[model samples]
Target: MAAKVLVAYGSTNGSTARIARTVAETLRRDGIEAEALPAPSVAAVTPFDAVVVGGGLYAGRWHKDARRFVRRHRRSLAGRPLWFFSSGPLDGSASERDIPPVAAVRRMMTRLDVTGHATFGGRLEEGAKGRVARMIVHSGKGGDFRDFPAIEAWADRIAKELDNRSGGGSR
Candidate 1:
């Protein structure tokens, strides 16, 4: 049977959600069974063979929902193959080089023994929820900075790793 993977995300302005979806899609294309869902919507992680958790970065922290999800599922997560990602740099720095996870995410990763992590660019456009988001948009600082190719490449790496671990068959 194919290994089932879950890509769970916490997105505030929807960009991280999109990234999560991209990860899931890429994994599927690589022959793994994968799905993406919002963090809060997942009742349990027990069904998945592996998990990828992602969140939007805000004020040097991960989205609250992502943090809570990790806390809630720590035990299940620790026993499985796990990875993490963060999407929240309004500039090109993420694409140019590696950006480490925030402090809290780092702690969670250490606790969970996450297999890997990536930092991707973020998107903040018009119609975003918060006052600060609106102000940033109005100030012309809000725009899509996500690098789809890079996101896909990261997913591909994850798929390859999973495939190797699964004997290169249906993972």
Candidate 2:
């Protein structure tokens, strides 16, 4: 049987959700069973063989529900395959440092011992907020920095990794 993977996300304006859905679709296309759902909507991971959790980053913090979900399920997830991702750098060439997070969250990621952690570019709509945001957009930090090809490649890699690990003869 194919492995079932859960792609759960916490998105404020829906970018992360869209990303999760794309990932799930990619996994399915690669012959892995996958489901994309909001982080808070996932009742349990008992039915999933692997988990991918992600969230939208705002003001250097991941969405609260995403953090809560991780904390709550860390135990059950201990021996399972897990990965994490965050999206919120409005600039395409920005580094990970450009999108910082609350210190405690960093510690949480370490504790989780995720198999992979990725940071993707984000998008800021018009009239969003703060002077800094507006200034950045004006200064050329606006537009969708999401790398769809990169996301698809990452999903494909995950599918391959899971297939190899499953040893069910899919390559």
Candidate 3:
């Protein structure tokens, strides 16, 4: 049977959710069975052979439910094929090195021995964010800065990995 992969995400204004859907679609296109689900909607991790957890970053932190879901399932996930992604750095100038710090989530991920982690750019609206979030958005630092090519490339890599593990040749 094909290895099942689940892509779960948390989004504030929907950009992250869209990215998760793209990743899931990419996996499916590679002939991998994948499902994209909202974080709160995932009742169990037992069904999937691999997991991809995605979340939006806000004020330098990943969404609360995303963190909680990982923490709750960390044990079941430890031996599984696992990947993580966060979207929030909205500026073209932002890099993994230059993006805002997310110390707490980083520590949690390190503890979980996360297999892979990706950071994607996010979108921001003028009035939706709170004062501080709005300031960050308007600080010449926010836009629809997501890189779709990079996202697809990463998803391809994950599909390859799952294919190898499932004794399937690369497409």
TM-score of each: 0.97, 0.85, 0.87
Model 2 steric clash total: 0
Among the numbered candidates, top TM-score falls to 1
Arranged by TM-score, best first: 1, 3, 2
lDDT ranking from best to worst?
1, 3, 2
Segments of candidate 2 deviating more than 4 angstroms:
94-105, 127-140
Q: What are the per-residue Cα lDDT tens digits for candidate 2 across 1-171? A: 688999999887677888899899999999999999998988898899999988888788887778888987888778888888788887765342434444656777678777777777877767656676677668866778788887888899899889888886566
Residues 52-127 of candidate 3: C-alpha lDDT, one tens digit per residue: 9998998778988788888788888888988888898777643444453378767766787777788888878676
Residue 72 in model 3: lDDT: 80
Worst 10-residue lDDT window, candidate 1: 162-171
Candidate 2: residue 127 lDDT (0-100): 69
Poorly placed runs, candidate 3 (over 4 Å):
94-101, 126-129, 137-140
**TM-score of candidate 1 to 2 decimals:** 0.97
Whose lDDT is higher: candidate 1's or candidate 2's?
Answer: 1
Estimate candidate 2's RMSD in Å.
3.1
